[model samples]
Target: MKHRWLLWFCLLLPWTAMASTVQATLDRNDVHLGETVTLNLRISDAMTASTPDLSALDHDFEVLGTSTSSSLSVINGKQSAELIIGVALRPKHQGDLQIPSLTVGGSQTNPLTLHVEAPDTSASTHTGQDVFVEAQASADHVYLGQQILYTVRLFYAGDLDGGSLPNPDVNGAELKQLGNDINYEAVRDGHRYHVVERRYALTPHHAGSLVVPSIEFQGEMLDRGNPNDPGGFFNPGGLFGNTTPVTADSPEVKIDVQAPPASWGQTTWLPARSLTLSLQGLPGDNKLTAGQPLNLRLSVDAQGVSGDALPALSLPTIDGATVYPDQPKTSTHDDGEWLTGHSERGFAIIPQRAGTLTIPEITLTWFDVQSGQKKIASIPSHTLTVLAANGAPAPAATTSPSAVATSPAVASSAATPAIAQVAPAASSPTPWRWIALGSIALWLLSTAVFAWLYSKRKRAQASVTKPRIEPTDSTRTLRQAFLESARGDDRAIQGRRLLAWARAERPGLRNLGQVADALASDEQRAAIVTLQREQYAGVSAETRMDLAATFAKGFAWQQDNQAGTESPLPPLYPFKLD
Candidate 1:
């Protein structure tokens, strides 16, 4: 009887685990006054489960928005489904808050607690408090290379005519905007206000205190009457109402960035909330033939980090294989407060001979900001059985290996190496060689006599001329067009001329924005920004851009900086050179 009971229990273990489970979760248990909290009621194995009645939350929190998602997964021949109900909430007031237990599909979730504090309004010299800007960071402390979301929000109950908010500068860190500006409406302190938010992903390379400086906003604000606002109560928003140019600064944030973990001594440092590495290669069976090339696309995607932070992956040079990599493509997308980055590396995998080759596995270990522990994502190693091609010739040189069989255009782009000339093969000495030598000796003697007579007859030249420092044809043409556009009233024409000049110098530059970023001087970047704002801003003309000055600056920069003329990098396939 005991053995039978134990056997029955063992068989039922999988059934028990596969049973449905329901739980309540929150993005954060703590919040700031006026900040929003995201609550989720998640159910596992819940295909028939109905949405939970969140009406109980109305007692403590007001629902801002809600969304639901369902997912399905299969494990060990058992299928499991999940339903997630997301609810965004704003606290009715500040203090301790409780999210009551929710029941769905005969399962009950434990109640959760949230703490809220009031926003600090201090150390500000402003004309009105109704319109202000504040900076916020996800965390104040992080490990080196960890990504943090740093955002600046402009909250305005009044009218905003126009403004300019500069990008933030963080020393020892890289901060780039996640996406374009986000505009939304949120209710805070029982009042509805419009918010303009700009978010950035900050990744620190060095361990230390990364200080994010305050961001300044210069703009005109319309005075909308506020019952609680002492300054804007008397003034009103209208065409001739109080329109004052206000200068506001966001709060400064300091991040305590620590070095990577001890176990992670020295390797590719990738710190993010989530990361994945995937490779898709042709000939899915992992079989290769001599002189046959495989096309591979390797993608590295990470959340909470920018695409630039994810380095391109490559294999070192292999003995019997060759690799040709194209230019890497990178892009970053913003998913609300989170940022997703994707980088692709394309390569042509060509085998030189028939042999079993192993493409080593690649592993990327990253520190999960949420877990505060190291996590790993890897691509498994692949083995290829290469058979000799039908009738391909044997590779000529084993030392240098053979070139890839793909597009000759790629090979032609490679540098043209110098070739040494070979002398004629030696043969037995003959009378014909002697006869040819005698004829050459007579010809030289006649040429020397003619030269002596010509030198006496001609006086070489009347005078020696000085070499002038003349501009190249292209440079002269660019200057003439640039001057004409500078004197003209059309900025669009001038912009085109400037772009043409820049492209002439750096053919790879796609636009003025790229040229501006490549410039090493802040003044030049500012000049480019001003020109862009005017050309696109559609505002009244203000500052003057000196075309000659810009030309001189660009020319000097080109002569000194080689970054703009970077060449294609070689492949990275691992092998020993003996």
Candidate 2:
């Protein structure tokens, strides 16, 4: 409590010393020819005040612009008001000049002096050191399939006023831009200044010493340092208390890119910080029933280091079962600094037959940025058990009648027959002594014959009412749809639909590969091949149509396979000829 009162008393002392005080100050003491300097005047504890006269300095300087901003701040529970006025002035010559004192509110500030020098005139210096910018590539050495990082920093210690800066250009490598520019306080070589840094993720096409050439940019420099204060070593030169402009060339960096190892045993080299290959719902012990479909899912993340690196993902060989390869979806992002970031890919796999199954291990290779060596990582192999298809058990053998008669309990039961039961005569014929048995047999045979005859007649009558349709019609209809889709709207979509129709119309084709090949013409096949390439190609309607058509044909073929038989004959109806 005593300290607060003491601070308040000290602050009140300033107001008492100078009533209704006004002060004027300049951000810079010097201005260059064609360059502007700012002069600021602040007024507090007063209202409706006029700005101080700058006409005295106007003779040697031109007023370019002026602005005013007011603010209120509370410190230590006391409110203070501040009104700031700024003037941008351009000097008339490259020589020492004085800015006269000006009054605001009631008090005035002392005069300030600044020195400006002539601009550098060398053409090479102007182009190389003065205005041009270039981005330098780092990590020149890298392994094949490995990633290197290249950072482009804009350096300007000289006159950069009125010039423009563009995003640094990087060519000759796969580049992924690191998020926003980094801004922080940095002291380089004992000189404290605000440094801006930007980075990119780069994957070398093939390992060799790769050059990421420089990028050029131009920007104007504002004289932000204290012009009159010579407190710092890198401050205004001592001779005349004058400040000079600084310009820098874009630093070009060379990286030693290492090549991937020649021997990656049964493993695709995936070098990344973190990677995961999990088959969702995979039997915990990789067990499966015969004819059950298997789904394998793979995910990879490598955000820690620079690389387009990823671990290989694959299905282990399951005995007697067909394995279908899954297409992968991949994506990447930069995690900022020393880390190239990561990407992920997913796949789906189905099992055909049952038995013991083994999924192969997936491997990825990359150059370790920290260790400066190439490394390979992998997703481990998996084993699965598939049970047999048929669920029936074998039957057991029966015991003979003779064996039963030899048993003591059976003989005793037979000898001690029931008192009410009558004994059969020795000469009696077998119990088929009734006429009803023959009559019933004859009746059953006659009924079966009549039913068969009636069924034949019914089928013949039905044939008269309905006619079989030619399978060619369905095939032709699908072909036409495919053709129309090719020329009409959503060609790719329509094409795929048509292919499905064809597959349904004809079941003779076994797999997707056969169906796609059989349904697609040579031109359509080429278009389909190109479509995969164009899936990630730059967006365009024409390209989209082409891709759609390509996929449509393949999928359509699959649909057609489900329709029924491969035979071109008309479908048979349960009816007789008219």
Candidate 3:
């Protein structure tokens, strides 16, 4: 038994050693020249802490830095450990580059291939500068109210300690940052640089020449000189502080803004690169049931514009359906180039009767900057077949022409006898005459009685005044609602209740803003303002002010000094127009 166990152990030892292998993977297989990529070398079941041999990569790539980490894990009652070494590499040239197999802990990893593309030729202008900035505009000339993309790039060869880049100022225009800054690597004149890029959308407000002021960068760069220098460390002479101040300014840009065309009529001037209208959430089958609601979304997307610049979207009145629309939603997205504005509105369409419902086509007109012409974006009309409501009985079946024809003789004979019998009964007018007179007499009596009761009720209604709750009771009820709402976290509900309470005292109050205006006390006004801001601007988790405590004693009314004043001229007609 001992000899057999030894034989089995020898066979298993080779399998265990084979299981300890190394694998290599790349974070990205495709990259542009001068861009960095990460390569991870994973050693499994091997506990050696030594780094992998990366000298083979020096021929086609530049090694930036490296890091190592180790983790131990157990699976199915078996314990194992792994060591991962991450290497950041930049391709020296463009093409397919091979990462040769690397050996670590007596295990060799698999090779990987990476594809690199050449860098942009525009970057060659700033070749040998330690730090420089450049700015460019998407268009040299644009119509008034049209958007122009402005881009600024900052290139530095070394590490930056700190920096501040202010936005460029453009006269007669609105400028806004497009998106977050982008950081990348670029090669200029055979030298690599770290680049920071930012984009802005500038919309010319007035027609004429507009100049965008130069953007400046103020910062400090870290200087790492030779370590062998004697004054590198603890330099009292202030010769080697290892920090150097740097500044770079981008050149100013000029754009010619033209006025709108004279032929363009009195419509909203919308100059954009592209625009589209879409309707979504319709049933795929184009079928609906009566009294069922169909939720729909109408959206408009335009490039080279802001969300606020777009007009509101609405649907026309539908013939057979009632539409309930929600508030419109508008937003803007920046793709490091132009601004894309999106506006969406939701509607619930309830079919009132069973029939064919038609929704009219939606159309929007705008000027296309790219084509220099007017364009229209539209959604085609939609038609839906509306069936009866659920649980409705099916229509009764009809008799076929052949079935009716087969029994025509019997049907005619039976119909003739019934017609003759009915004629004879109709000839007896005496009994029918009495019945008709009785009905006439009864109707006249009912009409007289109805008129008398209606007149009596109208007289009684005129004698008595309409019932109304006193102002104090109404105010108390509103105050209770406001207090109850204040105890909860719903700021909107509190604002509504507070407005109601205020309107009881000041009947003309419409909103919290009006309520604040009518309040006599400054503290109460301030509290109302805070509540309004919290509700309309945004709601926070914690209340900014204690609403219940502030209005505990009720509202203070602003005095009306001209309450009894009479107008010199006759009062205008009292017309309530909604």
Candidate 4:
């Protein structure tokens, strides 16, 4: 009998040693109420008959997902296996939450403690309910034609299957969504919830008490109880359970819309939080030649207004130049808080004659909503020196005859003719022949001198004009670098080299967009657009352009037609608001 018992003990020793051990651990011990915590249950040295029972966690945490992984390894000639079950759990409420012990493969895992903090009060607005919504406006009072930012947030705890949140309606105003709906998590009243945030820009056209209607959200909330419903123990309906129809509504907002102030008088009513006027494409040296187009960009950037609300921006009539305006561009963007509007208009200023070209100071008057005062944004007056068409100095109004006579070369040439005439007359006996010879010599000398002066002036003009047609060494080097970089896949280097080459032509060209606009060839413009899209928008490989091939012939610049007469329009308003 003792021998038989020893034999049984020897067989059971291996089984006892191989018994599974379960350990529970959390990836994070502290988290926000709406944030998820990872719970890992590690079972070593055993295989489980079924998944772990996690029904106890239903009270304090919601199971988002679960994953299982198994691995076997050998160390020191001993083989072992481990099974890790990961659970993503979001705390249902704030405070200290306990992860109850779970039974896995007939073994129990240790419990864990997690602390969940509440959500930010400024961003969260919730009641103790399953789903709710709230609305807020940027301001309660605003000027007519000014933009008012409206935000709507929907908070829910269950799975949202489908939903529709309609835009709010306002009397005598325009309301439109600024951007796509934003999905995030937040906690209110200790309960964690999923949040959908939406923004809108509301502009009141007529000044009066405006009432923005409440926005309502209707959706189907899926009841996914116990994501790992083992054997249908927690969810009798199987993997997918019934969905409950839910609805939430935001509160109506009231805004006091005031008209333009009495003091504003007779001018375009421009209401904004802030406004700025900028001018681009001006030469760094403020020097240009007649017949050369000075590309100019006049832009207006305003906060708390739409681009449509702003007046058209135009270049004033320059004294010695003609303005040819391009199609105006206006756009509005939202930065999650304020509605910013930008209006830009490009103009080609061609100097009609060589003189000092003065671009009058431009000013825009706007109502400052923040300060409750009037403000002015202006581009200061600009003075540019204009040269002749061939980059030569402008001719003087009047040339003094005495000045030319006193010239050293002219005086020396005249003296030589006189000396030769006197010498021939004094040496020769035939007075008429000597006189005729001397006259011919004097005439020939005078013609040669005049020809030399003319040629010298022409050479100077040719030198000044040669640079416009001939590329400098630096320009050629940059072009070669750009082409080489374009052949490779390094987009950043290609962009740098391309910009450098383009700047050699148009110094004011800042970005690829401007480069595209400056190009005249359709193919070159298309190539630039494609390159820009590839760099910024992550376009597909098929859309990639062969930059070296497309631009092999070189860039074709846009032609600016010179106007026959100066514009008759008045100068831009230079009103200053103190």
Q: Best by lDDT, which number?
A: 3
Question: Which lDDT value does model 1 have at 219?
Answer: 89
| Candidate 4: segments with Cα more than 4 A from true spot | 1-127, 224-239, 395-578
Position 176, candidate 4: lDDT: 80
Residue-wise C-alpha lDDT for candidate 4, range 1-578, written one tens digit per residue? 99999999999999898988899987656667667667988999864446677889999989887888888899999999998988888888889998888988878888789998875565344455688888888899888888877888888887888889887777799988876776556666677788777888888889889898887889998876656663375566554666899998888889999988888988788888888899999899888999999999999999988887779998777886889999999998876557888999999999987767899999888888888898888888999988998898666643244444566766776755556555654577487767878998999999999999999998987655533557889889999999989889878788888989999877888988888877778899898888878887888999888999988888887654321234588658757668
lDDT ranking, best first: 3, 4, 1, 2
How many backbone clashes can be found in candidate 1? 7
Query: How high is each candidate's TM-score?
Result: 0.44, 0.38, 0.49, 0.47
Candidate 2, residues 54-162: lDDT per residue as tens digits?
A: 7787788878677778887879998777777877676777888877777666577767787866542322333333233435455455655455556654534443345
Per-model C-alpha RMSD: 31.0, 28.8, 23.2, 29.1
lDDT of 2 at 577: 75
Residue pairs in candidate 1 whose N, alpha carbon or C atoms collide under 3 angstroms: 315-572, 315-573, 316-572, 316-573, 316-574, 317-573, 317-574
| Top TM-score hit | 3
lDDT of 4 at 534: 81
Candidate order by TM-score, decreasing, is 3, 4, 1, 2
Error in Å for residue 90 of model 1: 9.0
In candidate 4, list every pair of residues with a backbone clash: none
What tens-digit string does per-residue lDDT give for candidate 3 at 1-578? 99999999999997676577788988656667777777988888765558777789999999988888889888999888888888889899989999988887777888899999877667676776789998998899999989988889898998888999999877789999876776657677788888787888999999999999988899998776545663534764444558899999898999999998998898788999999889999899888888989999999999999998999889988987999999999999976578899999999999887767899888888999999998888888999888889735334434433444456565865655555655544578577669978998999999999999999998887556433335697789999999989889898788788888887877777878777766688889989877877878875756588889989998875555322246688769667678
Candidate lDDT scores, in order, read 0.73, 0.56, 0.82, 0.82
Name the runs in model 1 displaced over 4 angstroms: 1-128, 187-192, 223-239, 244-247, 316-320, 391-578
Clashes of each: 7, 64, 0, 0
Give the deviation of candidate 1 from the true structure as CA RMSD. Answer: 31.0
Better of 2 and 4 by lDDT: 4
